[model samples]
Target: MLGRTAATPVNGHSANNNPNQLALPVNLPPGQQSEASIVHQHIQEISNKRISTLDYLRKAHEGRVYWFNTLLFDKSDLARMPYFDSRRLARRATNHLFLGLSLPSVIDVGSCTPLEFLRSLNILLSEYDAFQQLHAEHGSASSSLSRARLPQMFRRSAPGSKVRRTSNAAEVGYPHDGGDGGGANGTHNNSETTAGSTLGGGGGGGGGNGAAAGSAAATASAISLAASETELLPGEEYTHLLTPSIPFEPDYFETFATLCDVLIDTYQRLLTLVPTPRECAGNGVAELFTKADGKLRKIIIQGTVKEFEDASRQGVKTEVANVAKVVLGGLIST
Candidate 1:
């Protein structure tokens, strides 16, 4: 009877297969240096396979950023406390998808579609309406503001004018002055004028100090119940003073601090994990096992996820020629 020799295979693959297959030099193909690290070995493997990992990474981040970007659309979700919208904020989603994907030099985005432009627009409009409706029902409860049961702060409705409780949102009125639009003096003057005229306009008997003192007291109380950031107009629902909403939250505003913090924390984690260009360099491409059919899934590195995301969002056509040079040592294509 013939005995199996060392060259015999238990399966179609060499019996020598092991997780450390990358560490062994004999398994490495030609062109890989003897001093190759696990990363370098994988690079050589990818080179032999010729996969398009760059396109996958680019599309992945593009998909994620598409959603994140739409979320950033101005006042898209204004009613939620901790509202966050900004390019910098969108960076986190882009970073996280790349880092969590086992980013070796070679990437294999086996099969997936990049996020679409139309989907991004739909997300923005839908979320904006949802957040606003949430506010209409729950008011400050959903906003980052503590559940202070704070009385509705509004710009006082002028006497004989529509006393309808106006919301800070539009439908109440057109946008306020093209700014934060609030000041201590302006707030004081308006509250006093409205209170005196509306409550005791004709009761001018002899309450000089009394009326003055009462008016001052009322003004102070109103100021405390609501912040002095904007003039509050009276409304049936006790709407809080509405300030101008912008399409993007700048870096400085304190009102959106919680939202900003969420983005900051997310981006910080992604930043910590992102690979440097040198580390991401791969010799070529490699095979990762697929879960569905237990078959080898090829991964290739074309560029960094960031490079792909920026290019896709900007609508630049990324040509793949000469990608190996860039992935191996040159600057990642943007």
Candidate 2:
């Protein structure tokens, strides 16, 4: 038999023809290996894709807003755009479709539906109800004195009444005990004692702790009564008193605080939909329409959530922040 050369295959077949033949190995320099590894790492990084809910919503909103802004600047372009019902849009939904697939960048939204909206609304409403309950309790508890004084206040304000208008008028000023200074002083001293007991009774036995707790509750009631007597309404001042002056053993105004937090989170999330000034300036054709109830069928940027919120932050701090807060807070958490 003929001797095989270095280029010959082990079996009598050429390297290309032999299935068992292995390809020659090429050794790369350390530098080249590192470069190759880096290239591969970059490729892997580029292939991996993920997006946050906020970013997704923002992109969808941006697309929608840009689309609208474009339409606002051009009239003839409407003939080229697709038409849909106004009620079909879901701001948070993927592609803004209330019940359909993604349309396009401008008209399409990410995955969100009416169910999500309802769930969010339920949570917000529940929180709001809890807040209302807590607020009512706080108000009723604190307003006992005010309600008590209502009779005296009404009597004084009655037409042609003999009650003097003095701030210290016995009829109106100290109406708790028939306007007796001694009675007022006695009640005041009793309140002080109760408050002192509540505060100073900390280092006591179990029974003493029980007594202290009772005294604390009594003190809160009495102080609230006194504040009410002084015309301190259920407002920021009252809430302030409740915060540090009284221990929040029962979570204090935590419901209200929670509502506020919820409102803030909702607003921040909504801000994601606010188009950049640049986006607002673009122009395009429009074909989107809302359910026909009022004017011609088409989308319009009427009073938005921002406008509603701006109008709602005008009153007492202890109360609700804004209408948008309540409505939007109930619609979305994130």
The best candidate by lDDT is 1
In terms of TM-score, how similar is model 2 to the real structure? 0.20
Candidate 2 differs from the real structure by a C-alpha RMSD in angstroms, to one decimal, of 26.2
lDDT of 1 by residue, 1-334 (tens): 1222433332234434433332333344444433334543444444333233333233343343242232221233222223223432332222222223222111122111011111222232233233233232223435343233223333332323332222233223322231122321222223333333445442122223454636654644432222222222332121111233221223222322332233233223222222221212232211211110011121112223343344444432233434555676645544
TM-score of each: 0.18, 0.20
The local lDDT score (0 to 100) that residue 294 gets in candidate 2 is: 12
Window of ten residues with lowest summed lDDT in model 1: 290-299
lDDT of each: 0.29, 0.27
User: Looking at candidate 1, what is the lDDT of residue 64?
Assistant: 30
Instruction: Residues 226-245, candidate 2: write the lDDT tens digits.
Output: 22223322332311011111
